[model samples]
Target: MSPQQKALILLEKQGNFKVGSRSIPTPGTGQLLVKVYSAALNPVDYKIQVDGIFVTHYPAVLGVDIAGIVEELGEGVENFREGDKVLAHGNFYMIDQGAFQQYTLAVATFTAKIPSSQSFDSAATVPLGVDTAVAGLYGKHLGAGITPPWAKIVNDHEPKKPIVILGGSSSVGSYTIQLARLSGFYPIITTASPSNEDLVKDYGATHFFDRHLSASQLMVAINKVTDSPIRIVYDAISLPETQSVGWGLLAQNGILVLTLPALVKEDEGKGRKAVHTIGSPHLPHNNQELFRSSWGMIEKWLLEGIIQPNNREILPNGLEGIIGGLERMRMEQVSGTKLVAHPQETK
Candidate 1:
């Protein structure tokens, strides 16, 4: 029999999560069999537990952000070998690719080496947040369709235009702020609670507004900061209320990128676009070429501090700690940080 590993399993659809044993999976072509040291929890994990979304397989392991050591490499893999630390965006469609396990398979194209200066917990936070941010900015069909900063012909020129992000303190929002800075969107504005103002600014927001501000108030305030039209609004919150606010702030021919489904009514022929982004690179719908292009740059960016990993809150009891962490996320208690679990410490 193959070596077995302990994993947190969702017993059934909209069902309980429990630690169970499963055979460790093997790496396939262009894949790495990773011994996942740290797995970060996202809101989607809790949603999958209760709402039964994303996963099609029962008794499924559900985690998307993975950071670990390469236990073994499959055929045709060259960049990494045994014992190299790496982080990857796990695929939701395959149980073998999930992160809520002691060992899982990672697609090499979407994986990046973790810098020696970073911890597994910190690296675990990078996958989903960075992917969502880059995809929203650079993805041709699913995103706002802006030119990628990683493009070969792209210049360091910063656009004088302004952008507004609706939830600057959230993970996706924080990354969006950084990427928007990289794309040279000047006067980068965002809305968050007054308490998280410093956190948002630390992530590269040029201007921060209280999230309680009305749409009209935000527009008025933004006008004083930059005379340029707000051509892009990334709504990382994407709740109905936030969506309405972001949609209202978009200019003609502007793009409104949403992390959640669109809630606001789209007016016909106005040239405004509302796009819901799926951050998973392994998904069939996303631009795999764009994902590969961005993942290639992550290591250098991490080492240079050009990209910042989200602040981390590590949970106790190893993999078991993930359950309560996900509960806190579901209850809306977590803010401006990623909840991470050490699966290798599981008893």
Candidate 2:
């Protein structure tokens, strides 16, 4: 294969992005070239484009999640073949390669084998969301009270406490509910709009509080579900108001895990712990192990039909579709369903 390939290029610092041909990257030692099938657009993609935090070069690629077939493998690569179907969280902060293209290269450790039954669009959504949830909940012992990796730490405690997952309708929140329930915690509760109450419950939320409810009303609903008060809170939506509510709802000595930096002023009376989580996809190194372990568990649940991927709305126009889809997401406040882009759309 030639060393040149086409890609979606983000030119300069003006946030202008376009699809164009560029050099096809060769797999260096321990790297693999993935023939891109579909890519997921994340909030980070637009955020980075506007803020320019991680873009070190002009004409950079902006996608983080990729699903497709492996086209070639570099020296010393193991555990993958040329035709293997795979999904990866392409190097997000790394400037050299990204998923928004016909072909891209990734380090071996950052990729996972996609189950044959999984569609490329569905597989594309797993890496970033799963890895973020895994790393946030598992890394630094944030989810220490929940499961085996952390079960030992909470063992012999007086009583297991309930966990509160904010924005449970979101993809990461949905997965957190499942993982929290699997870890043997009692009463995994979530907060979301009424329309998603049934959907969230099916994802392992024992109870769902309406996010639009008044704080007092919401507290009443939450209190009715658990007598001891929420002991651990995962703020999938990390707005200040939401954090305040989470902090106010938490029990003494409890911890609040947030996806974004907490902006709420800490209440002086509450002895609750505050933890800001930067999700897994952003972490450097150990990407492969985390991706494989979490995806392995997710695949099992999916195979058994115990857990469902979040509802998705497919954008069939491929690369050109992203701009309009993103605009819609921003305007409509895309709630429950993940917006997906199928790059191979027939045009």
Considering every candidate listed, which one attains the maximal TM-score?
1
TM-score of 1: 0.97
* Model 2: how far residue 54 lies from native, Å: 3.6
Cα lDDT over the full model 2: 0.73
TM match of model 2 to true structure:
0.88
Q: Lowest summed lDDT over 10 consecutive residues: which window, candidate 2?
A: 142-151
How well does each candidate superpose onto the true structure, as a TM-score? Answer: 0.97, 0.88
Q: Which regions of candidate 2 deviate over 4 angstroms?
A: 1-3, 141-160, 285-301, 305-307
lDDT of 1 by residue, 24-111 (tens): 9989899999999999999999998888887888878889899999999999999998999999999766889989999999999999
Candidate 2 lDDT over residue span 183-278, tens digit each = 656778889999999999988888888887765777788778778767788888877888888877777777888877767655676777777765
For model 2 the local lDDT of residue 253 reads 74
Model 1 superposed RMSD (Cα):
1.3
- Cα error, residue 29 of model 1, in Å, equals 0.6
